[model samples]
Target chain A: MESRNLFMRMLMHAVIIIMVLIWVVPTLGILISSIRPASDVLNTGWWTVFKSPLEVTQFTVENYESIIERAGMGTAFRNSVIIASVGTLLPVTTAAFAAFGFSRLNFWGKRFLFGIIIGLIVVPLQMTFIPVLRVYHQVGLSGTFLGVWLAHTAYGLPFAVFMLHNFFSALPRDLFEAAYIDGASLLSVFFRIALPLSVPALASLIIFQFLWVWNDLLVSLIYLGGTRDVAPLTVRLASLVGSYGQDWHLLTAAAFISIVVPVVVFIGLQKYFVRGILAGSVKS
Target chain B: MAGVTLENVTKRFGDVVAVKEATLEVPDQDFLVLVGPSGCGKTTTLRMVAGLEDITEGKIKIGEKVVNDLPPKDRDIAMVFQNYALYPHMNVFNNMGFGLKLRKIPRDEITKRVKEAAKLLGIENLLDRKPAQLSGGQRQRVALGRAIVRNPQVFLMDEPLSNLDAKLRVQMRAELSKLHDRLKTTIIYVTHDQTEAMTMGDKIVVQNEGVIQQVAPPLTLYNEPENMFVAGFIGSPAMNFIKVKLRREDEDFFVDGADLNLKLSSALLDKRPGIKEYANQDVIMGIRPEDLGDAQVEKEFQVSDDNSFTADVEVVEPLGSEISLYFKIGDISGIARVDADSKARVGDKIKLACNTEKIHLFDRETEEAIK
Candidate 1:
């Protein structure tokens, strides 16, 4: 029985290792290719680096410099940061209040309103673009960073409310009631008690919204337009592949560059990320 | 610190009424407990008093001010919830001081009050620890400290010690009584536990199905329950109820049940002379476990046939100090708390004597006591 159990465990671990390698190996290849010179990348595959692993001359900073200094990657990166930050902040702030209201407050149309939000989660974003863009144009926001932030906020609000609502609702009701009796106004309770206890949920939500907006291609392309001034990392990368389809080295460099912020965000927020899967709540 | 008066307070949730026209007056500094089994609206009534729940109809006055329109924050109350409800992220110091801080009290004053409360609860050393780091009893203390720091006009506790172990609950029960004595604040406590009500309440209000069954001082409520529900609910090993026909044999009053007949003592008749009116009809006799004893090991009461009945013992529960002898006096199962030395065992017929002086008689239909 011990031998059979050991064999089964080994088999399961082998499957897991293979799955991790499948995801990690390609990312590792892209990282290596991004540093290799355009001439060397054109000459041989990224795996050939093992032949002369100690040859530092094979690596170059030229691809990165070319992508940033020459190909407008710097502005695109900056634009992505601004858009994603504002987008994440706008939605999360609105969603937290909406979630608390939906979960904790009583109003005449509460059930109907929450039901509508649940229904809206299934509505496709692509279907709302044209009408939203019309309003965007009328407000002269058709091709701006603010336009993309607004669009992403609208796109993200439904799920954000749904996720935070479940988390907020799971928080014991006694805490809120206790706060009320302790002489805290509703706003005070929301800010001091509810929000503080909900750190993990909010942090994970920030990571989700930030990452989604950072990597989003469709919304930025449609709402902000593909201009050099307003284009994000994603749109720029797509354009790099479109206009310079043969520049594999630069595309590889751009790919690695685009992922840097999201990777840092995930790692920075990773501790809070999984802890909120079950709301670690007050005792009550 | 002031009294709270609720006049005709009724709470309704849609169509279902949770509290029905409950009227109560809690004088200043009294520990009033609302207790009943689950779903009996005890917690609902306490919440209504705290202004955490709205009164659907009626006036609730804190002192002389009608507070039906006041929010909980404006009602000058503090509540300790069953699970403590300590802010999980805050340390003990911050948890206790959070409400005062919100009230915009000076920093030093808040700290001073928090420290004093911590010292009072004997948790000064634990002030730096978060609620997650504290033991269940310690968390309960922190919850109490939080309420104490508020020093509100009224303290509302909803089964605050129900989460603790049995031993800790007893210890906390005593500590809470001491806290109440020291703080001198009106407290409206809610629990389903009868022991806590009996041990801590200055006045106990027994509720059943959203209606107040009886409200009186602990011993009075226990000894003279207004109805059968209160009589059954107030005691542990609750009062045994036997349906009996009250017979008037000249001046002597007798309660006759299946295989059981007991002449009502003159002392009970003097307190409740109305029992004579129900002489030819059926009534229910309520007796506590301790009120019945082994006739063979008798003490003060005489072992005459009028107050003694023979039955085969069905079970014997030895509780160290005393033994609970279980038997059937007909279809009705009865328990007698007899001295541990009584020689009663399962299957042996034992003659149990009822304490006629302490017998309670109630109407058969309404279940109300004969006053």
Candidate 2:
């Protein structure tokens, strides 16, 4: 019996190792390809660099320097940061409160209203693009950061509320009841108990929304009108790739630069997700 | 500091009534326990009093004001749930102080009150730790300390010790009783454990199926249950109930039941002369196991042919101090808790003496005590 159990554990470990390698190998290739000199990258395979892993002459920062200084990705980088931060913050804050209200409070049409909001997750994003674009044009929000942020928030809200509402509602009902009986107002209960314990759920959500907004090309392209001035890195990068598809060396540098923020956010929030934030709030 | 009055309070969830017309006046500084089996509306009644559940039909008064429509926060009560419900993010100090902080009390006062409560609960060393870092017993103390810091008008606890291990539960039971004595505050506690109710409560309300079965002190509830349900529920092993016919002859009263005929003691007749009216009618006789003894063992109660019943012992469960003799008189089964020295064994025909003065009779039809 112990041998059978050990065999099963070893099998699971092998399968997981294979899965991790499948995901990580491509990203590792990208890192190596980004740093190699453009001439060497286009000629030799990326794996060839591992033959002499410590050689410094084959690697150079010129590709990155060229993309940031010459291609105007610098401005796009700044724009993406602003757009993603506001986009992530606005929807997350609104959704957290809405989710809390949906979970805890009583009001007329509450379930019906929540159903309508959640039902939006099933609707295709393509169907609403034209109508939302027309609204943006009339409101003079076209080609602006605000236009894209609102669009991201609107597109992202239903899923955010869906995820957060489930998390908040699943929290021990007794904890909230205890707080109310302890003489806390609703806001106090939310800020003190619900919000704090929801950090793990909220962290995963931040990682999710931040990545979505950062990587988005279609929404920013449509709402920001494909203009270079207010366009984020995704829009600008797509345009650069279109205009100069052969500039793989600079594109590699741009791709790596674009991914830096999300990796940091994931790593920072990773610890929160690991710990059991609801521990000791109820029976262990 | 204040009493809570519930006047015909009824709670309904759509069509299913959870608590029906529960009327109780919990006096100031009294520890009143609402106890019953699960889903018996004991917790529902406590929730209604805490203003967590809205009273659908009647009014609730906390002190002099009707608080039927008040939110839980405005009701000015502190509750410790079965689950500790400690805030996961806060350290012990903050978990205890959060309520005071919400009331905009001065920082120093909040600190003092939380620290004082921590000291009282012997959790001062744990004030820096989060609840998740503590053991189950410590978490319970943190929950208790959270309530104590508020010093609310009333304390409502819903099986706070039910989560602890048996030994810890027993210890916490004594500590809670001590806390009540020290605080002298009105507390409406809810638990399904009759032992907790009997050991701690100044008054106990036994509920079953959203209806109050009986409300009295522990001894009174045990010795003089209002109904068969209360009589059966309050005792540990439960009272043995047998159907018997009452007979009256001149000035004496007797009950004829299953191979045994016992004359009602004159003392019981004086206490409940209503037995005279039950003559020739069948009644339910309830006898606690402890009220019976081995006829061979020397005891205070008299032993005679009229009071002793011969039965075949089926099982003998012997504890160090006493023994439980399970036996059958004809087809009626009963248990007799007798002296440890009794020689009663399995399959032995042993005589058991029942203390007739301690027996209880109920009208079989109504199932209520024949007072």
Candidate 3:
């Protein structure tokens, strides 16, 4: 029995290690290839670095400096930060209020309204682009920050409301009723009690939205118009790949540059990300 | 600080009625308990008064103003829920002072009132701790302190101590009574536990199936229940109901069952003017367990054949101070709370006496008492 238990534990560890390597290996390859010179990257695989452990001379910062200076990666990086921050904030704020109403309050057409919102998740974003772009043009918001924020918020809301509604509805009903009787209005209860207790859910949604918007090329390209000033990191990176497809070292460095903000965000919000997922599954 | 009156209040959800035309008056500083078994609408009635639930039909008044359309906040009420719904994000002081702060009270006053309520609940040192850090008993006290700090017109408690263990529930029960006396605020409490109802309520409302069965002081409710439901619901062992036919045998009334016959005194019949009308008709004879004891060990009442009978004991439960003897009286099972000294054992035949003056007879059809 003891030997069988040891075998089972070892098998579980092996499975987990395999899964982690599957995700981490590609990211590690990008990181290693980003620092290598253009000739070295084209000639050898990323794993060849172990053949000469002390080959410090093989590494170069020229690819990073050239990407930032010539490809205008710095401005793209700032634009990505602004767009993602606004996009994440807009959807999360609106979704929290909508989720509170959907879960806690009762009114006519409540079920019908929630059913419609949830049903909208099935609508493809590609299908709405032409019509949404026309509306944005008529309103003179196209190629602007407000237009991108609005677009991202609309794309993010349905799923955000769906996830947050699950968390908010699972909270004890007695707490809301007690607050009401304790002299709190509906909005006050939403702000003071619901919002505070829901930090984990909000943080996770922020991470999800911020990462999605930061990495998006298609939405930002269509809505923000791929211009030098308005283009985000994803658009610039995609354009770099299109214009200079042969520059493997610069492409790797640019790809790594675009991922930096998302990595920092995931790490910063990682504590809440795990807890929020578990909280939805467990009874408090 | 003021009374609450509900007039012809009814609540319906979709097609099912939860509370039906419930009328009640809770006077100032009174502890009124609404108690019944589960799904009896006791909690619904309390919620309706608190303005947490919509009253489907009638008007509810806090003090003198009708609050039918008012939200819970405008109704000047505080509710302590069964699970002690303290804000998980806030510490004890903040939880207690949340209501006062919402009312726009000054920071110093909120602090003072919170400290005062914590001191009153003997949780002064725990004011800084969040609800998740407290024990179940302490959480319950914080829930109570939240209500106490509000100083609302009324307090609505929905089984606040039901989450505690039996020992803690008893301790909290006494502490709640003391809290009520000190606060002098009108409180409407709901629970399914009869002991809490009997010990803490100034007036008890016994409800079943969304209708109020009887509302009276504690002892009056226990002794003079209006119907068979109240009689059976109020007591611990529950009142034994025996279906018997009332027959007139030479001017003396006798209750006759399949295998048992017992006589009723003429004086007892004279006192109950409606007893003659039940002659030759089937009636439910309700006898409490304490009213039935070993005839051989009796002291006060007359143990004649009119109220004494022999039954074979089926089970004996010794409770130290007293023994509960379960026996079959004719076709129906009955229990007798007798002195522990009685030498009664299972399957032994023993004579039991009923307190004739304390007997309750209910109509077979309506189940109402035949006064």
Candidate 4:
């Protein structure tokens, strides 16, 4: 039994190691290739550089510098930050209030309203893009940061409300009753008790919304019209691989930049995401 | 500090009635307990009084003011839930002072009241600790302190000790009685444990199936249960029920049953003339375990007949001061509480005497006491 257990453990470890290599190898290759000179990258694979570390002639910071100064990546980076921040803030705030109402408050047609919200979860984003663009054009909101923010917020709300509603519902009913008996009004209870205790859920939602908005290219293009001034990093990166599809260096640099914020957000809020997911899944 | 009255209060959830039309008066400074089995609506009644539950069809008055529509906070009542619903996010001091703070009491006054309540509950040193940091008993005390600091018109407790271990439950039960005495506040307590009800309540209300069975002092309830349910519910080990028929021998009445024939005492006969109408009719004879003991067969108090038969002991449980003998007479099994030192063994045939005066006679059809 002991030997069989040890064999099983070894098999599991081997499988995990292979899976990790599959995921990490390409990312590692990209990092090495991004720093190496364009000639070295074209001459040999990233692995060849490892054979002669003292050569020093293989490396260069020119790709990063050129991507920023010549390729207009700085403006794109700034636009991504503003869009992601506003997008995250807008969805999370509306979702929190909507979730609390759906979970706690009772009014006419509450179940039907919540059912409509849940149904929206299955509606494809592509199907709504034209209609939304038309509405934005009529309202004079197209090709603007505000229009992009609204579009992202609308697209993000269904799942956000679903995630947060389950968390809000799982909270002990006694806590709300205690607050009520303590003479806390509905708004006070929501602000002081509900919101404070919901940090894990809120953190996870913020991370999710931020990453989705930051990586998105389609919605930003449709609503913001790919204007250089308002275009986010994703649209700018798409433009890097031009209509002719050349310039891999600029494309890779922009892709890395776009990936940076999401990675940071994920690493920072990973614990809360795990906890929030479990909290929503479990009954209590 | 104030009286609470529920006038024909009823609650329903869709098609099911949770609490029937129930009227109760909790007098000023009285400790009243509502005791029954689970789903008996005791907690619902208490919640209705606290204004946590809305009355479906009647009036609720607190201190002579109609409070049926008032919310729990405006009802001036504090409740300690069975789970000790202390705020998990707050320290003990903040949890206790929360109501006062909501009422906009001065900060120093809230602190003073919180400290006093903590002192009274003997949890002064633990005020800085969160509820999660406290033990079960300490959390229960914090829940009580939260109620205490409010200084409300009434205190409603819903089985606050039911979550504790057996030893802690006993200790907390006594402490709660003492607390009530010291505070002299009108309190409505709910529990399914009859022992807690009997020991702590100045007046106990026994309920079952959403109906109030009996409401009286514990001793009165024990001595004169209005029905078979009350008789069996209020006593430990429960009242032993024997299916019997009332028969008259000459002028004296006797209860005849399987393996037993007993004469009804004159005291019971005079008080219960209704038994005369039940002669030769099926009736239930309820004898508490403690009322049966060993006796000389020839004693004048012994009412003998050919129906008296021997029974073999099935088990004997010694409870330090008393031994409970479980025996079977034919197919009918019963328990008898005897002296602890009695030499009784399993499978031994020991004749036990029944106290005729203490036996309760109930109409078999209605399951109500014959009075």
The worst-scoring run of ten residues by lDDT in candidate 2 chain A lies at A275-284
Each candidate's interface RMSD: 0.9, 1.0, 0.8, 1.2
lDDT of 4 by residue, B1-371 (tens): 69988888899988889889888898999999999999999999998887777788989898989998888888888989998878788899999998898899999999999999999999999999998899999999999999999998899999999999999999999999999999999999999999999999999999999988999999999999999999999988888888988899877888877777888888888877878888888899998988876443323355355223356889999999888888786677888887676787898887777777888999888899998
Model 3: fraction of native contacts: 0.90
Q: What is the C-alpha lDDT of each candidate?
A: 0.92, 0.89, 0.91, 0.86
Q: Which residue pairs does candidate 4 place in steric collision?
A: none
Candidate 1, A1-284: lDDT as tens digits: 99999999999999999999998899989989999998888899999998989999888889999999988999999999999999999999999999999999999999999999989899999999899999999999999888888888888999999989988898889889888877788898899889998899999999989999999999999988899899999999999999879988999999999988999999898999988755645433
lDDT: worst 10-residue window of model 1 chain A: A275-284
When summed lDDT is taken over every stretch of 10 residues in candidate 3 chain A, the lowest stretch is A275-284
Error of 3 at A246 (Å): 2.7
Measured against the true two-chain complex, the DockQ scores of the candidates, in the order shown, are 0.82, 0.80, 0.80, 0.60
Stronger candidate by DockQ (1 vs 4):
1
Best by DockQ: 1
Where does model 3 sit among the CAPRI classes?
A: high
- Model 4 error, position A183 (Å): 1.6
Query: Chain B TM-score of model 4, please?
Result: 0.95
lDDT of 4 by residue, A127-232 (tens): 9988888999899999888998988999999999998998899888778887788788888789878898788999989998998899898899888977888988
Best by lDDT: 1
True contacts preserved, each candidate? 0.90, 0.92, 0.90, 0.54
